[model samples]
Target: MKIVKAQDFDLRREVEYGSPEQNEAVRKIVADIKKEGDAALLRYTEKFDGMKLEAASLRVTQEELHAAYEQVEPSFVEAISAAADNIRAFHMKQKRNSWMDLQPDGSLLGQVIRPLHRVGVYVPGGKAAYPSSVLMNVIPAQVAGVPEIVMVTPPATGGKAGIDPYILVAAAEAGVNEIYRVGGAQAIAALAYGTESIAPVDKICGPGNIYVALAKREVFGAVDIDSIAGPSEIAVLADDSADPVYVAADLLSQAEHDEMASAILVTPSEQFAKACQAEVQRQLAELPRRDIAGASIEQYGAVILVGTIEEGIEVINRLAPEHFELIVDNPMGYLASIRNAGAIFLGPYSSEPVGDYFAGPNHIIPTNGTARFSSPVEVDDFIKKSSLIYYSKEALLSNGDTIMELARREGLEGHARAIEVRLLKEGKAGANDDNK
Candidate 1:
């Protein structure tokens, strides 16, 4: 890694990421699926996922789920179950209550909070089996009191047969009501517009490939979508006291995620920066995905040598990273200063995977620079709130004259007369007063 003066490193431009062409492809698929329905979905699924299944078999049955449990290791299933407990417990804190307040006048006003009737969570299976993702996406919906949650993954083919058994086991633990072995744009379309088999969902959550994101965009008006997630990212702000090895390892953790993934390190210590550079090289030699990590680092990574720790923090704030790790001394002191970040990991012990797995915080974080405005997946995503208002007869009577005056001022005679008629019926107004 080459050390760069802070001025030479660009932060604003680096934040903008994702493929525009992919967005276009998603639009086309969504439009066709809307017009052609299941037939269009089948064509896309077969073309993209290389699986051709009848629409009837899209849903995974209990028998298939049992087989999945049998296939996965018992220890893996148990671990997922344990993680589910933590995820559910954490999200339960985010649960909202329906509230109403009765006025002194005979009127009640408040908000009603209700869970979405149904939701669909997409799990990416084209590259890897994200059992962790299954847990993260499903647990929050369940905690939010969503009645039905469905999961979809690209169908396993050849010797591969279905959604990963580990993913299935996690889904089972996370309270997912149904699992579908379908993937890509087609899956998004199927969830948006009900097919012969798949029920239309009120909302769709979870991360996916570019095609999946495009499909979600196309279906926006028809169904709510959590967000169009981009490639993963991590930014580490450290000082001389921060361990170079730890910094290098954390940077590599995100770099290995994808070629487009970004791993940035900002430090005030030139000596520490060089040490981290060396440490990254030493560790990269042993990493399983070194090629991917190396490419990501070469293309998207940066090591900025700032003149001061405050500058490092400023750079991080400007980046608004998806994952922000503070490996500096007094990490907590700077927590409030960080206004933008999908998740913050303080101290070396709090590794990225901690939040990704056992920690109750949702791992579905904002990607690219979206953390500047968006937030991580939480129970709030599955619930909606409506405001309420009411007025008593006495309250209406007291305000009726002013209300009619405003309505008549607006030239809405009908509106004014409506209130006048009510007042007359209650004998509150003179019948001959014909202002009615």
Candidate 2:
């Protein structure tokens, strides 16, 4: 990691997000799936993942789900259950109810909240196991009363023909009834447009690699997506009272995610900056994913020196990191100063992994500075709201002219005419000359 002055660094330096070729490839994949359906799904599975399958065999069977339990230890089942309980409890607090208000003029105004009928959740598989994500994606939808949650993962793992048992176990524990053995851009397309075996979904959630991200962007209108997520990131705000070891460990946690992942430390003390740079080097030597983390640190990681803690916060807000840690003298006092982070961790004990695995908060967060506008996945992502309105005769008689007047100001004759027709039917208001 390089050390630099805050004024000398550009916080929004462009990282390796994706390429045009990848976007074109994803577009073609989505088009093929939309047109060819199951046939295209099978072809892409064999081409990208080397997994051959029949149309009937795409969905995981009850036997497979049961055997997934046997493959894992009893302790894993207990842990998943506990994590699921925590996640469920946290999201239950975000649940909403459909409500209607009775007006004085006998009008009914309301917002009807209904959980989506079916949703598709993408979990990255094919030699990667992140069962925690399964819980994060499904729990909020379940709390919002969604009836069906379909999960998709890569068909093969380490040259084998099955997903990781832990992923299957997590899904089963989370009450996911439907599971499909497809992945990548093809899987996203299949979910959006629906293959013969898989039905179409209202939305897609969870995270994936570059190809999956591009595919979601391509299919956004066809099917709603959680968010177009980018690489994981962390920005830690520290002072002279901060611990260098803890700061370095937290930074490496995100750096190991990808070469494009950014890990930054903003501090007021130059001594702490140098100490953290050296600590990151010492810790990187022992990490299993050292090569990837080293590349990330060399390319994107930095220790920036600011004049004061307030200046450090300004730098942090400009970057708008996916994760922010305030390892300062009084962490809670600085909480309100943070304006643009996907998640906030205060003090030394609240490590990034606590939110990633347990602690009841959804780990799926906005990346690539999108936290400035977007938010983490919650019950709202799995549901839709329909605004309800009922206009009484008395209400229309009192308000029709004002509505027509506003519509005529916007030059929307058709809108004004519709209101005029209603007013005429109710014998409330006069007709406009254009309509006559």
Candidate 3:
């Protein structure tokens, strides 16, 4: 790992911008899926996944779910159940109730929250069977009171590794109503367009490969999508007191995810920076995914030895990482200064994996500097809010002239006329600003 002094602009940009191939391939897959539907899906699945499924058996049934339950170890199922409980408990607090506030002029103004009727969730299968993702995606919708929840994952090959049975149980624990043995861009297309085997959904949430991300981007107009997620990222803003071993481990946790994933360390101590670099190499040698992690570190990872803690904060805000770890002595002081981040892990004990697996905060976060704008998946994603306005005859008469004046100023004749027409019915006001 290369240790650079605070002012390395080129390295920062490289870490922030992800691979262009991911974006280009996503576009092609989305276009193919849109034009060809199930046929396109089949071709790509065969091309990428090497799995063949006849048209009729795409959706997984309750019987299969029961069999999935039977397939997994009791301890694994229990762990998923516990994790689901934590996710549910955390998200339930995010539920919003419709409310109306009465104004002094007898008008009513407020907002109503309504859940989307149905939604589709995509879970990556094969070597990456994230049962934690099942909990994170499904539990929030359940909390938001969505009536129907559907899921999609690629089919397991002939008697080979299948979608984790632990994930199936987690789906059950999180109140997911349906599951499909389909994945990739095709699954996203099926959910968006509704083929013979799948039902169209109001929104789609969760994460997947580049093709799936492109599919979501392509189908955005057809159905609501959470976000076009990029590679995973973690930026730890630590001080001299922070543990290099723990920091290195947490950084590697995200780096091992993929070659595109970025793990950065922004610290004030040169000693801490060197210790972290050495620790990452020491830890990487023993990890199962050493090659992947090492490649990620070589390409996207960095350890910047900043002149001061304030400079570290400036760098973090510029990077706008998806996951941020504050390992300083006073985390709360810096928390207020943090302007952008999808989710923040405070203190030494609050590591990234806690949020990824057991902690209640949804692990589905913004990536590749999108944290400056996008947010983590929450109950609000599955629900919509509508502002409600009501004006009684008295309230309208009082505010009518002002409303008409604004409309006339904007040259909206019809808007002015609509107010005049309402006022005329009551015979108490005119189209002038001074009703006083």
Candidate 4:
């Protein structure tokens, strides 16, 4: 890793919008699925995933789900179950109930919160198959009371015609019985538009390759999507008090995820920056995925030198990293200064992987500077909110004239008349009731 002055380093990275050829290919795939439904889904699955399947074999059977348990160790099951409990407990606090506020004028105004009917979670197959992702995506929807949680993955794992057993076990543990063997853009289309075998979902969540990301973008308005996620990122803001080994390790955790992933360190001390830079190179050589992590660190990683800790924070806000670590003498002292991180780890012990797996926060965080405007996946992603309005006769009559005046000012006579007609009829009824 090269150490550079913070002001001299360019923070901008070109966003991946997919090549024109890839975009055109995804458009064709999505259009085919929308038009032909199940046939297109099957054809694309066979063409891309190399699995020829009838509609009957699309859904994973309950027996298969149970058999997945035998394949995985009891230790894995116990760990996942404990993590599930922590996830459920943490998200339950975010759950909200429908509420109505009654006014003195006998009017009601509030919000009605309801869970989505169905949701689709895409778990990538092969090397990207992560059981932790299944728990992260499904558990939140479950906590939000989503009734039908559907999962889809590639049919082949390691060139075989079957899903990963670990993925199956995780889905079963998360209470998702509806699992499908499909992947790539075709799977995203199937989830959004629905085929003969799989019902359409109200929302889609999870991470995937470029094709899957493009498919989600294409079908966004047709169904809700979590986000078109970018590669992982981690930025550590530390001083001389921090451990170079710990900081270097945390940065590599994200760098290993993808060659495009970024890992950087912003520090006030030049000596500390040099230490971390040397430590990272030493650790990178020993990493199992050194090729991937080494590529990321070589291309996107940096050790930025700042004049002060406050200056370091300003640099962090500009980058808006997906994961941030504050490892200083007083991490909490600078807590309020951080405004753009997707997830913040305050101390040396609160490693990023802790939150990624067992800490109960969703690991599906925004990346590529998206943390400036977005957030990690949470319970709110699976629920929709509708405003509630119940106006009594008195309440409507009291505000009717004002409402009509505003509506007519906008040249909406129909909207003005909607209030005018109600006011006129209610006025007459009130007069008659008073006379009686």
> Against the true structure, whose TM-score is highest?
4
Which wins on TM-score, candidate 1 or candidate 4?
4
lDDT (Cα) of model 2: 0.90
Give lDDT tens digits, candidate 1, residues 1-436: 6789889987764433247777777778877887788788788878877778787877888887778788878889888888888988899888889898998888889999999999999998755578899888888888888899988888882135667788777777776758777788878998999777688999999888777877887789899999988888999999888889889999999899888898999998888888999999899899999999999888888899998878878888888899999988899998888988999999988888889889889999998788889999999999998898787788778878888888877888888888888888777883324454
Instruction: Look at candidate 3 and tell me the lDDT of residue 188.
Output: 90
- What clash pairs does model 1 have? none
TM-score for each of the candidates:
0.92, 0.96, 0.91, 0.96
The 0-to-1 C-alpha lDDT of every candidate, in the order given, reads: 0.84, 0.90, 0.84, 0.91
**What ordering of candidates by TM-score runs from best to worst?**
4, 2, 1, 3
- Candidate 4: segments with Cα more than 4 A from true spot: 158-161, 428-436
Least well predicted 10-residue stretch by lDDT in candidate 3: 9-18
Off by over 4 Å in 3: 9-47, 157-161, 432-436
lDDT of 1 at 54: 85
lDDT accuracy of residue 289 in candidate 3: 90
* Residue 313 miss distance in model 4 (angstroms): 0.5
Candidate 2 lDDT over residue span 58-118, tens digit each: 9999999998888899999999999999999999999999999999999999999999999
Residue ranges of candidate 2 with Cα displaced over 4 Å = 15-17, 158-161, 429-436
Best by lDDT: 4
| C-alpha RMSD for every candidate | 2.7, 1.8, 2.9, 3.2
Instruction: List ranges where model 1 is wrong by over 4 Å.
Output: 14-24, 157-159, 401-421, 427-436
Candidate 1 vs candidate 2, TM-score winner: 2
